[model samples]
Target chain A: MSLLRLALANLFASWLTSVVNVLLLALGTASIAILLLANAQLSSALSRNAAGIDLVIGAKGSPLQLVLAGVYHADVPPGNISSAEIERWQGHPRIASAIPLSLGDSFRGFRVIGTVPAFASLYDAQIADGRIWRRPFEAVIGSRMAAVTGLAVGDSFAGVHGLSDDGERHEESRYQIVGVFESTNTVLDGLIVTSTESVWLMHSRHAAESAPHQDGVASHDHEAVQHDHEAKAHAHEAKQQERDQGQLHNSVIRHGDDITLLLIEFSSPIAALTLPREINAETNLQAASPPYEITRLLQIVGVGLNWLNAFAGSLVIGAALSIFAALYASLRARRHDLAVMRCLGATRGELFNLLFVEGLLLTIAGIGVGLAFAHGGIELLSVWWGKGQAISVSGWIWAESEYVLVFGLLLAGAVAAMLPAWQAYSADVARTLSAP
Target chain B: MTAEKNRVLQVEDLEFHYDQPLINIAKFDVARHECVGLIGPSGCGKTTFIHLIAGLLQPIRGHIQINGVDLSQLSERETDRLRGRYMGVVFQRLHLIPSVSVIDNLLLAQRFSRTKVDRSYAVNLLEELGIAALKEKKPSQLSQGQAQRVAIARSLAHRPALVVADEPTSALDDGNAADAMRLMRTLTAHADAGLVIVTHDQRVRREVDRVVNLGDVA
Candidate 1:
């Protein structure tokens, strides 16, 4: 056996100790790798979903909640704002675009949003099938939501009264699927898009049906007039009337009627400075900057990620020390063999390399197993997190940061080996060999 | 080549110091193809003297040469290289690498000594030692006598010019010890190397060409 092979063999001779050291290292490396992958995905999803829409204007509550509700559609909005108030910001000189969203009902836990077609274009959304909604009560669902719900063009589904599937179904107000969006990998992928008028119509029908009947669910059953030829005819009639009533519905926005929020863009950097302040101060609505709120949210979450990084870093350090202890103890047991090697004409450097290479082998094996385990961990999380989710997590992404982690971990391993190697290097060969 | 024709080992006016002067030899020499025995009572600095001869310890005042190369003139690093290339030391413990197979043990000696790793020659040495079939066995798997044979095979792997053994047959029964002494004599003669053996046993005296008492040297 060459000295390298001797190092490898020595480790194998104490195979149980070697395996324990390797497992500790793998566990540490895996944790670091997982942190790197997960953090990158979280950052990408946060920034990508918040692109283009500079500010979110909604009811005054948590500015974070306003951004989460209006930008992400992941939380309840504070409340709705009056349409006259929405019209106040619509044609303002500082405003580039003010897309209104009316949120109330959901289908199968996917939000059925009331918005203009500009909302889809805001995400650079492309149609994957059929066409965009042209009238009230016709919906174009996000591709991911479409796949999950199994909704196709011409299929009709009624809105649920709340955000969750367990909510009361608004059976009187059925919206037909007109189109499906391409998977944008953005927040838009989890939503169903219909015009603001469809939201008003769904609420109006629900109100009309619920007013007279004590059992609101019995008054408009979910199992009626769905996909029948008569239902199609009735849908066709409703579409024609809604096309005529589009302008009339604009005037129907009274002092009592309200829409959810406005996602506003800036005409200039000057408008970004003025508009959010003007809306928040002069008007009774909150305007939260999407970039500002997202950064704040990430900073809050960054603290937790930092803790996890520290925990993983400590684990790596612990693994390094464990390896050091194993090598050190093995050196004590092999001192006689080492003295014999010296007598056999192995130089101090050769003996040093023997123990050093053992640590080196353990480090390489641990790093290799750790990286693989980390990537596998990310894959499991991706599966548990579900595909095409808002977070867009993946295990296969190879970041430069992971390479940096490997380099750092390798350095830690080298340091762990240095003590035993130094011991081997400076051992008094004659004295050791002469000992009984 | 000239050094090989002269003597394999030489020592004159040697003094080795530890906390005290443990070794002080006035004159010693091993001619080409000779077997020499070092017999002394326990605690007579026999191991210390051998270690100094091997360049594992430096003499405070002495001239020691292996194959006519001066140990004092060379750096400790070069001395180590010299020792590996020209000599094989068989310790009392027979320190073969415990996890490696017997054949690999010989290869390691050649590798550390910077000699050409000759597997066929290693196998031949094991054959001469009569442990050829045990070539693939680990040191842990070898019997005590078989382990001694493997150690002898490893020391003679590159056919060094000088061979040193420390109490090689002390732990063996008389039958195994006699067998070991016969093999040592046969192998040293086959390689034409000078041999030095340290022992406290009187039974070891008849196997060598000359005897040196460490008490008389001191």
Candidate 2:
């Protein structure tokens, strides 16, 4: 008989066991694939966000934490840094533009950051509807936040006290949604952006209620409302006048010198070198170069994660070895079959081919099944993740390296079958035929 | 036997062993169209001697020539070629390839022999062996006698020069064994192949041209 036919017969002789082995290998491969894919995407997002800014000036804390929380939206900021201290660095020749950030709130597990109009513009954030926030308490929702929370323009939602799902609620300081930002495949997908004044207003309201301080403050009742309305009207007129005059300084700073983090951009690369260190040593604040901090963090975490991947890879190798052992053990049971072929004048090389064909069949079946499983799983994850982001990937996410991995696995199978093939080759034809 | 005509198999000083040596036949030969019946008690080397002659085992002190080629000095590939070209085998237990259809079992001889298969001949042999309807059936689906007949058909399909039957009737009833032996001897003589059957059963011994008791030779 042809060696291929013989191999097929042997593989199917224990059909259930062969199927189970393929399934096991596929599961292990798919698990590693999903983990690696997620890690690659997350790392890419972090580096992409870090690419836009030169330095992050914030309250002195872990620079890595600040970069992660501020740029990538992965974690919380280290601590609140005073905007008053940040404002001093704004007009310096070394600093081109100093954008402020105010954090410490969330809407349904998504962080709410209060930033200037420049924040949206710098990030190229487009609005699906309505305009930017022009007053305190007005907010803009991210595409992912809106999709998940179902919050639209003119809807009001209260900010929770923490980043987690079970954080306390600040129901008293509910924010108004004035705009919805279009989908951008960045951290904005899971963030809430508004004016810095809105965050300061929320915190100030809490402070005023607790302390009941009135000295040097505007009237708290009807007169305060009336005066604030007049101030807003005057500010609007001043903006129109500045537009006509061709000088853009009429924009009002409602909460001056108060921000949690500052995203800075310098006019030149040389400014980045001296400006960050100067800011760190000259002021009580700390400045972090996002790219550097991110790379360092990646190096540290990447080393640990890569080590884990290697360990997982070795486990997969162990699975392959077990498969080899199982196939080899089956050779003894198949000796009689081999003998029949031998007496028919089947060559030793053909006998070896029979075993190799069996191994190839197992490897291909395992990879095929595993790929299907991984595709289905990745689709499910995409549905869940797309509810919070705009990134999409294909079902058959075959990379150049993945094919190499599969080839390597198939080669290992061949190597595993070699021993049994050699045994079959060296088997005594007469002895087996003579063996009852 | 004639000096050089129709001689299919020859052996000289053929020596074989198990854990301990026993029968040591000095000379053995079979010509084409001849039927040789080998009779011996249990553990008397009937099976071992057939195995050595089939090139399945190497005799320590002699040579085996099948179709005029020395099997002892041949490489594995050469021996396999020699076996496929000149010899067919039917064992006591009927070693039919279990996973394949009966026809495939017959075709296996052709495939490994690397020869053009005669499907009609295989079918005709199966019909003569009383398993014509079982061509597509697996060995597991066959009765013991039916399986044994199929094994014989497989051996003769390639039209080899020598056919070795190692206890082909061991598991059969008296009538079935007699029928099997008569059918095999008639098929071998018709194909002009030398038939060498190893069996201890005296009931089927009378059908062959000659019967040699291995115990008498030893």
Candidate 3:
């Protein structure tokens, strides 16, 4: 038997204490590893979803909510902005491109976004089957959406009124799945894309059916009144009828002649410098920078994560302390045993190494168990969050700071072992052997 | 070297004191393959003398030469190496590492000495001691007599030039004590190594070729 084997055997002799040390250290390691994986995934997901998009302009509300909803598809949109306002922003010479998103509907909890093809191109999404939506009722499903809903090309499903599966279904408007986009590893993967007119037409038909009297007046007035005074009276009545129609549409659709938000890219750096301030200051719409808002969100989350990390750090310290106590106690109880070893042929350094090897072995076992726990937790989370998309968090891609953590734990273990090892090294062999 | 050429152990004016004199010897020597018994009453420093000769304790003013090397002239590490290579010790307490099996305890000597482990030789030594079947057993599982025999086997596993056994049979009955002494003497004689046994039991004196009574030396 080698020194390491002897050390291992001795550790197993007091298996309960070793197990306690292993468990505490494993828990600490698992927490740290999980924290790193989650932080990395969150940062990557945020950056990927927010890339190439400079500003999100939506109805006045929380800027964070706007980015979370419009950019990440994770929350309800703050409110909707008018299509006229979106077109006005699109026409600005300083704007490179503006993509208007018409939301407020979902199928199986996956959002149905009404947008032009530019929205798909923004995320580098390509249709993997059939073709893009070319008509009001035709829809293109993202790869994740198709996999989750089991809706392939040529399948048809009705949209739900709100951005959740339990919302009221619009049974009158059946949208046929015309295509499915390939996986883009972005928020776009969880969307159903249709034309803006589809949302408007579906809600407009509901409005017309619920308020037939309003439509009757506009149609009937056009058939009468030939004289100038009569024509003026008819025109006035029509204007009032049109105003009534606008109110009915707004009440039914929630956003009158409007899209949910505008995704804006600046043609010049000057637009980034000037636009958000001007828009938030001058218009009813709120303009938000995606990168800034996401950073603020992460900073808020980092506070709690820091506290969790502190708790894990304390556990690691406790593990090391436990190792020290166990070794010291064992060394005290095994004084004669060590003296015997010395008598047999072991030097002081060899005895010291025996104890050191035990500590190192415990730490290594704890790390292995902790890594397994972390990876298993991440795998479960990935399966839940990404569903059928299989977002994997598997790798040894540790951050530089994580390397410091690993080395620091090893150092702590070594330092913990060193004290008892020194005692073993300098033990009075003759006195110990002579003792009863 | 010339003076120590035929002696496995030699001592000259050995003295050890801890606030007072615990041991004092004017001269002592053991020739190769000789069995020497050290006899003393309690508190007479028989164990102390053994420790001094084994280099576990440094003498205040003396020379302890084992296998032609002076123990006082060597560093702690050098002395440990020399002891591991040339001297084997059996403590009175039979201090076997309780966590390991008997065979592993035997192998531990080879491991610490950085010598090649020979399982066949260890097995043969255990068979000679009549504890071969108990090699796989832990020290805690063995009887008092059996554990003492295992400790003896471990000490001699490296086949040292000198074997120092301290009260190896103190806990045994008369019959068991005689058997242990005979086994120790036979094994050391067969290996052609000198043996130093420190004991107060008068029954052990008959088994040794010479007796050094610490009462006379101190």
Q: Residues A1-436, candidate 3: write the lDDT tens digits.
A: 8888899899999999889889888898888888877788668778888888999999888999899888988877777667787668878998998888877778877888887778898889888999887666678998888877788999999888666566768788788898999988888888888877666555554444434444422211111211112222333334444543432222122223557789999999899889999999998889999999989988998999999989888888888888899889999988888987887778999999998888888888887787778877777766676555423354444555567767888898899999999999989998887777
lDDT of 1 by residue, B1-218 (tens): 66546598988998877787778888888876788999888887898888888888778998998988999999988988899999988889998889789999999899878989999999999998889999988999989999999988888998899999999999999999989888887898788888999999888998899999987875
Q: What is each candidate's fraction of native interface contacts (fnat)? A: 0.80, 0.80, 0.84
Relative to the true structure, how large is the alpha-carbon lDDT of every model? 0.83, 0.75, 0.81
User: Each candidate: RMSD to true structure?
Assistant: 5.3, 6.0, 6.9
Which ten contiguous residues of candidate 1 chain A have the minimum total lDDT? A219-228
lDDT of 1 at B102: 94
lDDT of 2 by residue, A164-265 (tens): 656656688788888999977677767888766566565555444434344323221112121122333334444433443442221345433346688888
Q: What is the descending lDDT order?
A: 1, 3, 2
Clashing pairs in model 2, backbone N/Cα/C closer than 3 A: A83-A257, A83-A259, A84-A257, A430-B56
Candidate 1 achieves a global lDDT of 0.83
Give the best candidate by lDDT.
Answer: 1
Docking class of 1: medium
Tens digits of lDDT, candidate 2, B70-146: 88889878888889878999988788988788998888898777778778888999988888999999899999989
* Displacement of the residue A271 alpha carbon in candidate 3, Å: 4.9
DockQ values of all predictions = 0.72, 0.56, 0.75
Span of ten consecutive residues with least summed lDDT in model 3 chain A: A219-228
